[model samples]
Target: MRVQFSIALAHLLRRRRSTLVSLLGISLGVAFFLAVSALMRGSERDFLKRLVDNSPHITVLDQYRSARVQPAELRWPDAAVAISNVKPPVETRGIRSHRSKLESIEGWPGLRVAPVLRGSAVLTFAGQQQGVSLSGIVPARMKDVSTIDEQMVAGTLDDLAAAPNGLVIGQGLAEKFQLGLDSTVSMVTASGGARVMKVVGIFRTGNAAYDEGETFTLLKRAQVILARPNRVNRFIIQLADPQQARTVAAGIEQAIGYKSVSWIEASEDLLSLLLVRNIIMYSVVTAILVVAAFGIYNTISTIVVDKRRDIAILKAMGFSATDIRHIFLYQGAVIGLLGSCAGLMLGYGMMHVLASVELKPPGVSDVVHLPVWWGAEQYLLAIAFAMAACLCAAYLPANKAGKLQPVDTLRGAI
Candidate 1:
């Protein structure tokens, strides 16, 4: 068996170019597939981590039917009444709150609740007007939800100067208005066109959507401008442990007597996008691998016919058909093994090259770094698939050699 294997190996080496090409095709496909899969997973994980780290774990909103509300019109539920409503709430609804009820959630177990006043409005300065969504936050409360104050690119939210009338703008918004720190702009309320605000500081949130359209003002000032005087939209909450988010969220809903939602629950659209991307990616890679497998089949089939005469000679020398088949299969295995190894190395090298290149959209951050995930599992999977394809590729050719008639083969008849 060992001698037969050596003879088979010699044949493959003599036709090294064809074997190499076949191996190269399969190896390249595996490498590309692995690289793409790693990149997609890495990007998703990074984005999720950043989002969770920088944003509140939970948020409490009034679950209102309309945009604005007045405390006089709505009675604030007390703590006892709020807690008694303990139960799971519906999705897509914000948690309900009044100033007293919202403020009451501050000391809840494993939770930090912060009242927020939010609304959409238009900013007008130097005859340049842009529409933006304004969030009224207590700087102290902002700390509980995010470390965004530290991410400020050009100005500080301190321009609110601890004053009720102070305001901050996102970096993208700042560029649009050509505004800087201490640069003031008038914010016109979209609600009944009732108010205006002065932009005191500009802040960059590092999120394109938020940075371009988001602005912040002190909670008290926001109330005054929007004419709500003493009410807020919702209480943004941060949990002590992220793993307990659902539990904490349920508690908030019951404690606040209103519907509540966690980030994972609210981010269904983003989740859908990720799922679609994964499906598309896997489907494309699978197709490429299938095509590469066919190449293996073609190469193996051609080599089988070329070696039929040799097979007949071996059979006449007393080699069994099974032994003949094993020789050709071994040749295919060698090709598969070498091809897969080379592909993995080259693929990883390409990924390293990609890592050094900075990628970003125009007028966006200077660089967007992507992460790469490589492991033994990926390599194993690639090699396993390649070998399986190679084995299948060799079967037909080997069978043909095994069934060859020695008499006709020796007479130079195919």
Candidate 2:
């Protein structure tokens, strides 16, 4: 094996140009694979972070996911009685007995819950009217679960608690209505009730739709203006570890009989899209390494054709077929090992360069740098795949070399 490896090294060194070209190809492939994977995976993580930070981990709505089964259906076991057009009774459109339900939820450890009465209302300022989503929140509880506190540009959520008639609005809405803190605005609800409220706080979330269409006030005030006293339609919850939201939401839904939605469930489509994107990315990048492998194949195949006499001579001199094959396979392994090392260093440099780039996109207030993920698994994966490709490429040539006949080679040379 040592003799075979020495011969393999000598062959590669003799065909220096071809070997270097193959090595360069493999290195470039691995480098690009790492750099691109870092960017894509990093962007995914950044997007998810923003989503998790901005919204509740779990939202408990004032509705049931499925219709209630009638008592007749429960009593009969596989009875073929069919009921048609069974219209359910009209009831109040809010979470029933919310206080007791909220208390039950509060008993759970590592959860922060804030009750919200979300509704729609028209805002009138200086004869300009705009419809916006009105959310009634307990300021103190809301601060614990939401990023609104951090996003506040002018005032704090505590302002809502201090002033019962205080309103917290987004920067987009304030700009549209030409209003500021301490400004008065009339808000009219669909229930034919109107109230003049004072602007106490302003927030900017950088999302145009949300910034322009959302406002918040005290829970009690929202209940009064929306004509639903002592009622809350939603419970916004944040968990100690957001990843456990799915399990926690299921438990809450079963216990309270309300519709509970986790962020993971709500973003299922986006998550699926990201997964598909990663698959496509990996396939395309892996193809680059595969193409580089073809270079290795061509180089080894050429060597086998040129050195048939040498292979036959070795076989005649008692070199086993397996030993001859190892000589060629060793060449591929060496190339793969060296190329992968060089590629990893090059890829890290590329990622560093990318991370330094800064740009200010449209509508954004500050410059943003590219996101780059540095995970050890990505490096290991690139090296492993490149080596596998190199080995597979060398196999055919190695086998051909091992099968050379001394008599046939001598006759052909003559």
Candidate 3:
């Protein structure tokens, strides 16, 4: 092994220019792989964080998964009765026995639940009217599951609790209405229920749609205005582990009979797009390394051709074909190992530069930087792929050199 390694080292030292060029190619490839992968993965995780923070992990709506079946069908088992043209009765659009439902949800491990009575209403102030999605919530319970508390720009949910008729609105909505804290506005529900409410809190969520259209008030006030007493239309839930949302949502739906939607289910199309984006990213970056591997192939192929006599003499001098193969393989291993180390250092430097950059996004008051996830898997992935590509490139030349016959070479030379 020592002799094989020395021979391999000698081959590289003899062609320092080609060896250096191959090393540079691999190092650049690896550095780009690590840097680009870290940036892309960071952005993906940041997007998911926004999705989880701004919205509930799971939502249990008042609606059922399927339409209610007729009692006559249940009573007649094998009668083969087909009922036609039956109109379903109009029922109240709110979850029944919501207190018990809330209790049941909170009883489950690692889940936090909040009851919300959401309805459409118009905010009329000074003869200008704008439509908004109004939500009634219990301040204490809501804080546990929703981000409104974190997004508040003016007052807290406790202010709404203090004033039963207090309203919490989005910054865009308040600006449109020219309203502020303690400003009076008349809220008219679709059910013809109307109330004079005061703006007690203002929030900005950075989502244009929500910022311009959503409003929140106390649960009791919402019930009174929406004409649904002791009832809620949705249960907004958060989990200790957001990844467990789908399973938890399924269990909640099965237990309560209402339609429960997980964040993953709600964003199926977006998630599919993310998966495709990752595939494209990895494919494009891997191509860079694949191109770099060609440099290794060229260097090794040149070495094999130039050192034909050397390989033949080594084979004649008690060195086996496997030993000859190992000599060239070791050359690739050396290049790959050293190149990967250099690439990792360069990649880390790139990440630091990216992390230092700050940008002011539109509609956001605070300055933010690019999200960069520093995880170990990407480093391992870069090294593994780099080594694999290098080894594969080395194999062809190594195999060719090993199969050469000393007698044929010496005979051709004469």
The number of the candidate with the highest TM-score is: 3
Clashes of each: 2, 0, 0
After superposition, candidate 1 runs with Cα above 4 Å error: 1-8, 38-58, 64-113, 121-131, 158-161, 175-178, 184-200, 206-209, 227-230, 237-257, 262-265, 306-327, 359-381, 398-414
Candidate 3, superposed: residue stretches over 4 Å from native: 77-79, 361-365
Q: What is the lDDT of residue 288 in candidate 3?
A: 95
How accurate locally is residue 9 in candidate 3, as Cα lDDT from 0 to 100?
90
Q: What are the lDDT figures for the candidates, one per model?
A: 0.74, 0.94, 0.92
RMSD of 3: 1.5
lDDT of 1 by residue, 185-299 (tens): 7777845544445556666667777888888888777776666666777777877787677788887777765667777777768878989998898778667666777776777
Q: lDDT of candidate 1 vs native?
A: 0.74
Clash pairs, model 2 backbone: none
Order the candidate numbers by lDDT, best to worst: 2, 3, 1
What is the Cα-based lDDT of residue 368 in candidate 1?
Answer: 78
Q: Candidate 3 versus the native: TM-score?
A: 0.97
Q: Could you give candidate 3's per-residue lDDT for residues 73-160 as a string of tens digits?
A: 7788566768767897787789999889889988999889999999999999999999999999999999999888999999999898
RMSD values for the candidates in order, in angstroms, are: 7.8, 2.1, 1.5
Best model per lDDT: 2
